[model samples]
Target: MKQIFTLGTLAAACIIACAPAVADTATQPTASAGATSAASTSESRKLNKLADEYWDALARFDPVSAGESGDNRYADQIGMSIAPKNRAHQFALYRDYLKRLHTIRRDGLAQRDQTSYDILDYELTTALRFEPFPEHLLPLNQMDALPVTLANYSSGQQAQPLATVKDYRAYLNRLTQLGPWIDQAIANMREGMKTGVVQPKAVMVAALPQFKQLVAAKAEDSIYYTPVKNFPSGFSDADKKKLAAAYRSTIAGRLNPALKRLADFVEHDYLPACRTSTGWSALPHGMDWYLARVASQTTTDLQPEQIHQIGLKEVARIQGEYARIGPKMGYNGPASGLPTWVSEQAKYKPFKTEGEIIDVYRKLNAQLQTKLPALFSLRPKTPLDLRLEPELSRATASDHYTPPAADGSRPGVFWSVVNDPTEYGSTGMVTLFLHEGQPGHHFHIALMQELGLPDFRKFGGNNAFTEGWALYAETLGTEMGLYDKPEDWFGHLNDEMLRAVRLVVDTGMHAKGWTREQSIQYMRETLGYTEAAARNATERYMAWPAQALGYKIGALKIQELRARAEKELGPKFSLPKFHEIVLGEGTLPLALLEKKVDRWIAESK
Candidate 1:
């Protein structure tokens, strides 16, 4: 899942009390040296205090985010985030934070605090810059939406805790608010219809099934009743009975009806009104919107045309790799036909049950764990759990990771979406495990939480750093000797090709006005995705602009930085140390990451 950055609850008082304050004399030039030092120290203290306050306020504003981060203090609340008044209040909060941040002297902050200052300034500025756009009008999409997210939570195995009686009641309270949230979503879409900011017709058509499936005939059959079926061991029969009754009531009385209403409304009202054109460029001020998304998602200044060209070059380069390796795999065919040829190989589709598919990932994890110490000196303390993606969400979901609870009550989970084990291929398992499980998200995210970074840095992430690091992790498979087999190597390259194709296809659609069919065909030919797979991937880009671009763009940047480090440091460069430098500061924007690496090289020299 993409990282959600709503407000979270941290102990503001404790954070402010324990935070260190130090001075830099650069900004207070007119004062005497001692006076400058004191002034700088005071300003630094104030900035730290403000950072804590901001985190606390965010938790109150978006309790679901807070709960996801393991702050159960707000577990009972689910705020109306998309409502106009709430959105105005949220934007006003951003403005206030920005105005206050401008009062601080960045030059006067100590080096560590300066990084915090810059990050906060960038975040607040970005939020306010997007204020003019009515993102609330289009609340949900096929790729991601509140309903899908909440459904995942209702399973009791996701971010929402269901370990105790209080946990159960907290979820019940959260469900009570979903009805109003749905009502507000309908209202927002109505507003969007008037403003010409609605979702495209194709996007809505793909999203319809998600809502429709939630409308079960009885509350007992609803996904929200999942928790009741699997009560914790210690719960008394009386408590279980009461909780189950409460769940059935809430699901029947509040949740199911809201879902049915949403499904009906989308099928009847919203689908017809949705735009026929697939590109974001078709909407009002859409080119600007797409540009902003490109900048924000990649955290780079590269224009869409530049990115598009880079993608085209990358596609050609990866195809060359395929040609060189194809003959080794007993396929003397052209590079374009390699993936299709591999797909037809019976040996690759060996799994017959979900258990067998998961066991491959387990075995991969165990094999990779022994090899990790050679490359990474720093690793996360958090344990990772492997599981199948819940049946309700598997259709639309992809393989992904969810972070462990901040309190350590829950372990990080890698969910593999296996809709059909018979059709599931085994070639991607090794690289997939590397990217979504160990040493990738599990290591990067869990280690960040363990490092005791500031609340904002701990819970927040940008796609470039997070997704880029995962893609980079996939390349490590070659070094670890996991891709020794011809078929395994093909799998790794095929996955890489998908990311490369994303660059070409995402930009082609959003910036160059490529049609949905064009995007689907490009993916099918380049990556050997089946027609269904290709269509699903195409609609994903349509629903989420600039998101797919992050994997390749981010991975390339990290690779570039690694290459520079190797050349500059020579024998002195340590692979583990280089990784430490990259992953040490949590999820930084690409520019900040580059600066950090450059500084490390200079210091080591």
Candidate 2:
């Protein structure tokens, strides 16, 4: 419903992209109503059409996302990146969609239709605001571990399949598009730099290895050729030969050269210019920009100062919980005063091999499943798994979660970085699983799709509500009885420390003008992270700026609300029903979420 900074020349193009409202979730957004103005119906229909266009476009935008979700429409369309022209077109569609959505008198629509329209408006506008900001251009970043996304395609278990002759061709097309995309990515980054919008120095360092891996000389040596070695059975020899040749040419002639260009630019030019500060505030209008992002992420009108204060309040409350547990564990303060106990904690060691690390997580995930029903009435229908973060992308990557496709073809995954397990700190596994796997991201995201809501809301998430949910899930271990064990309780504390530290350091860097070193130091002192992990997180902050601020600020709000509901509902409060209330509407702006929950609680009473 709100507008982002307009794209001047591309503004018209963006208007069309904006028209779809909620692309993935809104196709069947609402119940149809009888008797409306012909013009109003036409506009509503136009907005609805975006659901189809968005899937078609999204399948194009990220073929892996499409294939993983079992939408075979894009199954064969891989190897091509989004053409800027498509972006220009979508931009216009989105802008116009927003305009048309507003013109309708919302209350005139049926209840379901009205709600769908509200959600559609929010998702479309968020997409529009995000589009022209060069995010479309710089697709490869340290975040998703881009190189790993490629490696997983080769790994056979992930989204990009190794099934058909058609599948191989799909990848070839993907390879063909890589070089041009890289060029576009670099051009965009450079352009961003012109406006003081450069990535943090830490992120630039992370991008280097991806370039090096892709630029390798022989086609077989490249990760793309990996699947070529283990092709699916029953393929014709001639087709194999043809596929192999096409891949070799694409990798050697197109992909490798592009990598060389990017690597050379990164090591030789871009790194030097990367900003030393970790916050988005370093960019032009950076403060205003971060505030907008915070708003978008949380889906709320809370200002940065409000979120910051909320973060402080939540940190103190969590510390009290930690204090109650610390004496039982033989530690007194929330501060054992860093070094001695921090390093000496037995769980703070590394895995000897990558397999061991992956195995540990697999075991933990399985452990949780056996106990899940006692605490959660709602869970993901999708299966869950743990995988090693691919070696090629581990240097700059962190542990992450990738939710299953709506169709259930690909299982939700918890990927751990095996780059240097010692650096990762072993103590956080249980808490991490709850956040990324069990009651955290996987459940939240998967259920959004399962709910009978507009597709727009189904697939969309507010960062504050989403990540906040994960962080809050970390604390739920106690209620589930998992935290009765001292070690698991410690894991919860360690994770909370990480998020609380994020509040202090993320604010310190962007708001208070702390240097990158200062931010890293603050984390090291507070979070019990290794120096290396601290460095990685600080750099991530530099690139993403205020994104780190969302977790604690968000989780605290949910925890507070839950407490309020419990006291008010008293004997009548049902945890399962309460959870349904929290998740039932899908992710909303925090304010909307609170209002909706208040209504539910009042009616339940």
Clashes per candidate (backbone, < 3 Å): 4, 30
Weakest 10 consecutive residues of candidate 2 by summed lDDT: 1-10
lDDT of 2 at 593: 62
Best by lDDT: 1
Off by over 4 Å in 1: 1-41, 69-72
In model 1, the Cα lDDT at residue 90 comes to: 74
Against the unseen true structure, what C-alpha lDDT does each candidate score? Answer: 0.81, 0.64
Clashes of 2: 30
Candidate 1 lDDT for residue 546:
82
Identify the candidate with maximal TM-score.
1
Query: Model 1 scores what on Cα lDDT?
Result: 0.81
- 1-605: candidate 2 lDDT, tens digit per residue: 00111112112221112212232222224433444455346655655665445445544555544454344455544422334666666667667666766776564454455556666566566666655354443344564434445655665555565677877887677667667766876776677667666777778788677667666668889887886887777998998899888888888988888778888987887888877766667776667666656556555566666666665665566567666766766777654343336457765676677777778778877778877776668776777777777665465456777666665656777778777655455656788888987788877877777776555455444567778888988887877676767656777887787777777767677776778898777767665556887888887666555666667767877888888889999999887777777877677656656766677678778
